[model samples]
Target: MNVSLILIILLIGALATYMVGDKFASKIALLFGLVSLGASILLLNHYNLGENIGLFTQWIAKPNISFALQADGLALAMLLLTTALTPIIIFSSFGTEVKNAKTFYALILFMAFAMAGTFLAADGLLYYIFWELALLPIYFIALVWGNGDAEERKKAVVKFFIYTLAGSLFMLIGFVYLYQKAGSLLIEDLYQLNLNGTEQIWLFAAFFLAYAIKIPIIPFHTWQASVYQKAPTVGTMLLSGIMLKMGLYSVIRWQLPIVPFAAKAHVTIMLVLGIAGVVYGSIVALKQKDLKKLLAYSSLAHVGLIAAGAYTLTTDGMSGAVLQMIAHGFVVVGLFFAAEIIFRRYDTRTIADMGGIRSQAPKFTSLFLILVLASVALPGTFNFVGEFTVLYSLSQVNMGFAIVGGTTIILGAYYMLKMFQSVMLGETNAKPFADVTANEGIVLVVIISVLFFFGLYPKPIVELIAPSIEEIVNQINRIK
Candidate 1:
């Protein structure tokens, strides 16, 4: 199967799910999500056998843009993340009530399609288009379906929409300039453009602005916590889980390689910004009373470290970023789902209002505790493997960078455990807090399983991403 089939499956699924109406939309979305996951698996197998599954054909002859989709190991790994999580995200919403269920489910599938395209598109313009398209579904999902006061939700969502859209325009300008110099917008062509130091610096800033805002690294992260708190749980999941990775992935795939000299020159600044986000995010997370907002800041901190690793310009750093990207996706989704679970039962997200859930729901407490431990990168969980590798890569750059970046683990454990104790421990709430239903249990089980399984046996992921990351590192260090 060609890589394009995955996109086609999701697009068709989106349309079909919408047309089938609300009653069947969720099931259909889940089915299509599973099918797409299966398709990605088949493509991965073909890719492993060294069969070409990517698509490349002429699109707009005038602009020299082609409809290209490349499925190297790195892209496929991301595609797998997108597909695997789509179903889980959908399934997580199964028992929850949703307004305009058809539109909601369809949008989720479409967002999946857009995110997959973003990962696979090899043409710079195509990738940009996919990147922006991913925003639309989430915007509507947050604005229309989100919670909180109407005006407040609007303010938050609009700020997010404007911040991301504005940042992306800078990136588009950079791509336009690159197209002028290279005579093509294909990624391979862009990489070969031997631009001077001045040009590289400009292009680097443009792309970095876009990525930093999307990755929502510190300073550029003002829009994050409010939006995360306001958006529906599913929308929050899509944003935190998959959409954030789009920016980090682009740094490796687009930014660093095309502007190697500038990237190399500015490594220290990048590392500082990344670690700053780590510290800043973690500290802010400590003060959050709202569970989702706390997790939002927590996400900011985690991605900050991931971005730091990507900026380190080493193979270990890049691979660790990718591995952590996948791990963070699952863990964050589970954590947010846990928040949703609490919100569902107690009808409150305030940490102050929650208490003593362990007495009522052992299964939920156990799973949530495990997820919390994974978030802190406990030694045996998948998060540890990624966090440790990222830290080691930082150390190779500078011990100071590693030391500051490592604060994420310690600070994360502190706030997450504190939140858990407040929400799940102490005197039992007079209101009933049920154990996780079978569906909820299944979702948490699946997430924890991936964490532990990969934690112990990360060789598969490490091996899969190594060659691709090595190529990017070579490209970054190669000077014309």
Candidate 2:
């Protein structure tokens, strides 16, 4: 089957889950989630064997857009991340009380479908459609199912919607301009256009505006922590675990390659912005009193570094960004899940309301500790591999950049460990804290296993994505 099967499966899953009703919605959703993951694996195998799994065909001939999906090591790696985390995200919801399970599960599957399409679509307009489509389900997920005051949650969700949609309009404008000049919205065609410095800079800014907001770098990040605090844990997981990667993936896939001149010239500016977010996010995270909000800022910090690595325009930088994207995807999901676990028992997201759970639940405490350590990029965890490489890439650009970016590690450790101590340790609360249930244990174990396995042996992943990273670097170098 072609790569489209993965998308088709998720689409069908959404419909089927909705039709099957609430009683069976979660089950069907999980089943479909697993099946989609299997399809992605099969497609990956076919791709490895050099079989063509991509689809390119006419969709709208008038505007020169086509229904195109490209499958390469890089795209498949992202597809795998989307598919793999979906089931875990779905299963993670089983512990919580979900009103209107059918709608909730269906939206999750549909979001997966859109995200998977975003990664695979090669035609520029088609890619934009998928990119925009991914935002809808999350908006509703956070708005309707999200916690907190109704008016406040509505405000946060609406702001997030407007911010992302507004940013995407600029991107849509860029694509239109590219299509006008190149006579096609296909990525390869856009890459071939002989744009001068001015055109390249403008287009890059347009696309960067969209990506920067979605990646929520610095000033544009005002919406993130509130939404993360308001959204349901499952919604938060989907956003942190998979959706943010869409922006990072687009930087590697569309932005840098299409406007190498601007990317090259502004590398320092981008690096500075990214490093600034790293510092700002880390310090803010240290001061957060709410657990989810702390994790949200931490996400901002990690993604800022990833963005910096991508802008470095070196193979090592791009590769590290990809690795970190995958590593962050899993780790953030696990960390959010841990927060949800605590909330499930204590009914609070405030750090002050939590303490000494370690006394009651050793298993939960140990798992949470490992995730915290992983977040800090301990030497043996998968995060270290990605973070170290990113720092190395920054050092290649400028020693000062590396030194500044490296603060994420030290600051990340201090804040995360501090959060852990406050939430998971200290005097035992009078409230009894039970260890994780079988389902919860399974989720944590599965996540930890992947982190440790990849930490020790990342060769397969590194090799899978190496050629693609090399191609991107080659594209950047072609500017000369």
Candidate 3:
């Protein structure tokens, strides 16, 4: 029941890396990342499966909040995603020269720790604290080591930090209201609170603002494209890979259950908005000259559909959302790293300025093409499974809505393929191009393996999370 081990190991890993000199910082951080990933993997063994693994103790007598960490199937799936990705994230940065390497890598580990804590927390206040802690490291990562003009970077970083922090405050107020109503901050206590329809609406909005800002659904997403483009590729990976999922996971775990009536009442228009993001982000992406920003907007489109699936309140939709989060995470990171590889070689990210790479580097071209297919959710790729499941869930709800949402597949293919052709194919560039290195080859191989492995056999994940998603649906229905 000591799921806190993941947090402790990660935090200690961050500190231990700092105590060691900069010479070995990245190596040490990667070691710790692997160690944490090992622990989570061990937990997934059948022997360790059953009752929730948690550490619970009293921390504050006044507020009645406990130092609590709970891990169930849903939480464990997220923990697995975070822990598994952190190592790849660490591995992804090994070749780059990072100043103050200790600090930079430590923040990455700390970010993992905070995100893991967010997934495992059983107390409302504890969850909020971990949620906010997740923001600080990425803020620094983007501010200090991020790319682009100094003034522009500062503006984007500050705007992102302030926007998300402001959203958190509203969520905090919602938690506090639930606390007052329930007389305790335990999630179970909050779940049992007998709030009225009016109260539920307020709580739902507050919590939605927090999650939506992080997910950056639409209007609240002003900071997403800028910060993503300005941040280092690894930072962008962290943001796209695991950070955005926190908001999405919260929507399913925290918001919907606490305010089921509000969720039920407002879900139609909210879903329409989610579908709107799909159209808006795609059309915007179609016009993007910058590779990173195009990927960012494409991400907005992908997550919009996931958000819409979540609010459907159907078992199939919730299951698809969880599945899609994992799918999107791996695909997005691979895509960003592909962009980073291009930047490393060509010193540019503009799609218009690139061509004929496939002629020189067949290996890199093949990998990039695979990711492009995965992103567009080509049949037999991992994303297609989640996308199909979600679209099916939507179809069950409203065939027309599913049809609108389904256009992402078409639009996704149109833009991603155009970018792929512009950058990876066609007439030779005057500049020389090198094929994928052993390191880059290994990373891409791992990514492709993961996408296809579950792409073909997603039963393990589906079985793991299905019961929990069904429980959540039941919870939503039972709310008074």
Candidate 4:
């Protein structure tokens, strides 16, 4: 099957949209995104039946690097997530007053291409290329089309770019070493390399450094809140909803698989750090008065739990991490869109200023409540399936880890309820709080429906990803 065709479609659409100009760029981008999603679904169905979707060519013969792209279970799942979200992101942007709409919409498609390329690249150098490619479009999007004071936005975007790029340098170094040791940049070759403990240790640190910054775990998270606050809703959505997953996905795909010894040896400490982000992020969220920043911290906590799950090195944990990524991706997009909807009407993000929105706009309130519930992993929601599985995995490892990690549940509920009560449940405001518009309603409906569908019947995703999770688990277990 044609794995890279989606990338071609998205990239070509980006260029064409630029040519068509702003008046129609949004519609064209959305159309391309929908087509890409349809193709990915077909590939996913083909993939589930145990067929390969691979593209290979010699790119650098001397160093044994290839322009290889493969969509195994893990890659397909991530690719599907990227394609599925792109249309919604574009559709969600339908009402925004983004200057140079053609450029803005085109960049979104380019970013999607880079993300898909990152997911499908089966060669180390190629993967790194795609990974780095993703950072540029989002940077410009946030910088050029962002909200707030010009000086402040520039500072935040600059910090974000510098921090993430610095991390990428380390990942590149890690890849270089692996290439030298294995004599090939192919993922398969690196996976099969028999490195000693010392080499694995350094390589693990190198790769993890990049992922950590992108994941923005604990201290590295400095760039996150400000960037989210400063960015336009579209920028915030792309960063939180999809870009962050790149780091988590790389952890599962590259770090643990190629350097299992280091992963296992350091698993406990790494897992501890991850759990710390969960507790830390939630506690911070509880203190935020700004709705967007509050949601940012909430995102941090959810992803921390997901990261902890990945580091558990168990089938359940890995599977849960994958599922949670998809769940969280959709939920966060809806949440941010809600935030934007609120700001559009009221022109303020301060929690203190938001009240009686529910009384004014019942439908919007209901959808938001559902997203809030899903965010906290309420029972009968898709989040619960993944969160429960992850906690079970940690508890199997040590009840203590589960105990610590589970704080997000309590902390999450506390802050989300607080946000809802403050923003939606008060006396009706004198200011207007209109219901969700048709465009906005469509996006939210799709998000909620998918969450519920997967919540009730998650077996298809679990089954599709089971083999990849099993393969990853076996790799980690084989470490010695």
Candidate 5:
């Protein structure tokens, strides 16, 4: 079947799952997710380098926008990540008991649609619509089903909503200004528009705020820890695994080329902030007792390095940032899922409360250990491939920045291994616990296989994304 037809069927399946009620909704969602994954793979296989496919058109008059979708290497990579994770997220939810399973499954499918739209959209307004649309379902999912105290959940959700929305408003202003200047909402048109240095600076700041809040660089990251701590395991998985990359992707797609001069001029300060965030997040995570909170801080550190790499504008840096985005998405989800399994068994998330779990759950301990190693960027894991590329790229820009960024590996290992030792080792003193269940084992095994497979053979992904990075770099060079 054609791409458009496949998308339509998936959308229908999403709605149908919502209508089908609780009993079979999850199964239907899983079925549609698999179909979407298949379609994404087919699109990737058929992807032609230097070719653009115009999927559809909308808004003929007044700005000349189109419902256009293309399968460039960058878009395809993100599509693969999204599709691959959807079913895993769905399956992970098997351990969760939601009030209305149908609504829950529907939300997951709808999130998939929104994410696909964000990657595929070729128009600025359309992309922004999908971007904002993606936030609502997740907000509800977290607020309704999140763990922790009731008030804390509410506060976390509200803080996340407000922070993201505030940033989004700036993005909206930036896009509107682009539309006014370029007389079109097409992303390509914006790239060609010539703006003065002043305009570029202002527009860049506006766009930066939006993406930073989402990637959540240092100061803007206050909301993320609590939100991650409060969110249900599946919710946390989706937020960390797939959603955060939306911001990183936007920085590459929208901000850089459109305002290359501004980005280049202020890249030093941005790099400083990135380095600070990396160090600060790692140190803070080292002290976190809650597993989710620790993971949240670790995510902050990872994205800070990614933001630093994006600003470097070097080919290796950009490509590494992209690869890291995909790698972190998978690795973070696996870690969070492992945390969820522990939480489910012991009914607690505090490290001090968990002890001797490895004695009772050997498979769980083994899987968690592998995931921890991946998180710390051990060799033969995808995280190692991504971090090596990113750090090497950063070193090309500044040895100091690379040195600071490298500290994350040390701090990451300190915290992760400490957590593992606390939870997975020591004398048996806790209530009875089961080993990793079949579903959990499957989820983790898939993640591990992908992690090692990509780690050992990352050339395919590098080849796929390099062309787009080259295109973007060429655009920035034109401005220079």
Candidate 6:
């Protein structure tokens, strides 16, 4: 009857995809994506302050947990991002020869259901359940359908699985500790419970480690590049576009308010690590020859800055982090999609193997150029807006960190342009390449439009998120 119900219907439609023949699996996924998008739009239209919708509730006496679902501005934003990208990822996979197409499509839809539950779940335990639930399908999707050396792909998936699971166990420990203290697993209840400085510190540590691994912050990022490189483009898109944000979102939603004292105490350490990640990731990306590996490192650099911004505890920092999450999600998806197009055309992802493609593929070259500029945080692009705000917020904490972190702009531009020149500028090194196909063009155009539209007019997104961020910040300050 309402948007939430429609979303549930879409999830059912996705599961029903299993019954459809393999030939129509991709179409079914696309249809589910469309319906999910419509549901998101309807939800947005009906959105209001303090609005909470519950789909289910049940008592769990042992830990005082309850099964529940709720919606707010943050949840809505994440839902919108997830639904909007599913169709594009499905569309982009159209030409690929997926052997178990029906099962593949079913997994994608199930992943959507899990992701939606992650955003909507009101109970911490339920949220964690959805969080872990979201990973299995992706792991299989990557391992089974992934490209590159088969052995390497298997290793990558296993490593990714093990690393993420290890980190999540720590987070679960934090939740159990919280349940012991608060006698409830509901997020609202957790928010209301009082916590001591020492307990908060340990809890925050557990939560931060888990989220850092998911975000793939510098030192914990060994598994990401290989995973990104091996996974199919659709898998990579979903991982970067929607999954990475889970960590950043959890930082804002869980760690900050729940462990305010510890956050305040360790803010400097967080800033130091964040700045280090920013510089380190950018520098490493500069040396990457494979496009997927390059983008994977680039994502690390961007998330580093976002993590720093979130830890700043300033309104600008938190709000900018959220916007940056949305901005980077779109930009990175576009960039990866561009890489996919290039690989499809050249049958290679190595930068050295691509050259002078601009002459024969002007349209592809032009679009690639736009995406590159966006990646480097050009003034007119969404990345610029997010990065600028994040840096400004960092400046308020320590000008030195801000300056060091800000160097990412110069480094980003250098590597992105270097990549562009290597791949798109020189003489045709391979068989004459054709322009982007209609499906590819549609995906690129939509992404570009989103980048430009948001870059020019970010006020709506800012307005939607500001109040919730303010409330969270207030809660953090109150706890302090």
Itemize residue pairs with steric clashes in candidate 4.
Answer: none
The lDDT of each candidate is 0.95, 0.94, 0.91, 0.92, 0.87, 0.87
RMSD of 3: 1.1
Cα lDDT tens digits, model 1, 1-480, are 677999999999999999999999999999999999999999988888878777899999898899999999899989999999999999999979887899999999999999999999999999999999999999999999999999999999999999999999999999999999989898999989999999999999999999999998878999999999999999999999999999999999999999999999999999999999999999999999999999999999999999999999999899999999999999999999999999999998999999999999999999999999999999989999999999999999999999999999999999999999999999888899989999999999999999999999999888878888989898988874
Across 1-480, the per-residue lDDT of candidate 4 in tens digits comes to 688889999999899889999799899999999999998998987887778789999998887889999888888888888999999999998877777999999999999999999999999999999999999999999999998999999999999999999999999999888888888888888888888999989999998889999987876899999999999999899999899999999999999998899999998988888999999999999999999999999999999999999999899999999999999999999999999999999999999998998778999999999999999999878898889999999998889999999998999999999999999988766689999999999999999998999999999889878888898888877876
Q: List model 6 lDDT by residue over 1-480, tens digit each.
A: 243574575578677788897988889889988888888877777775334445556758775678777767777787888888888888888867888999898888888788887887778998999999999999999999999889989999999999999999999999998888878888888889788878988898899889999987768888888899999998999899889888998999888988888999999999988888889889999999898999989988999999999999989999889889989999899999999888888899998998998999889889989999988888888888999999999999999989998978989889889988888887678577889999889999999999999999988888778777898899889864
Q: Show model 5 residue runs off by greater than 4 Å.
A: 1-9, 48-51
Off by over 4 Å in 3: 46-48
Superposed model 1: Cα runs more than 4 Å off = none
Give the root-mean-square deviation of each candidate in angstroms.
Answer: 0.8, 0.7, 1.1, 0.9, 1.4, 1.5
* Backbone clash total, candidate 1: 0
Candidate 4, residue 179: how far the Cα is off, in Å: 0.9
- With candidate 1 superimposed using the best TM-score fit, by how many Å does residue 472's alpha carbon deviate from the native? 0.5
Error of 5 at 325 (Å): 0.6
Q: TM-score: which is higher, 1 or 5?
A: 1
Could you tell me which residue pairs clash in candidate 2? 356-425
Give lDDT tens digits, candidate 5, residues 36-153.
Answer: 8988877777775334545756766766677766667888898789889999999888876778889888888888888888888888888899899889989989999888799989
Displacement of the residue 382 alpha carbon in candidate 6, Å: 1.4
Ranking by lDDT: 1, 2, 4, 3, 5, 6
TM-score of 5: 0.98
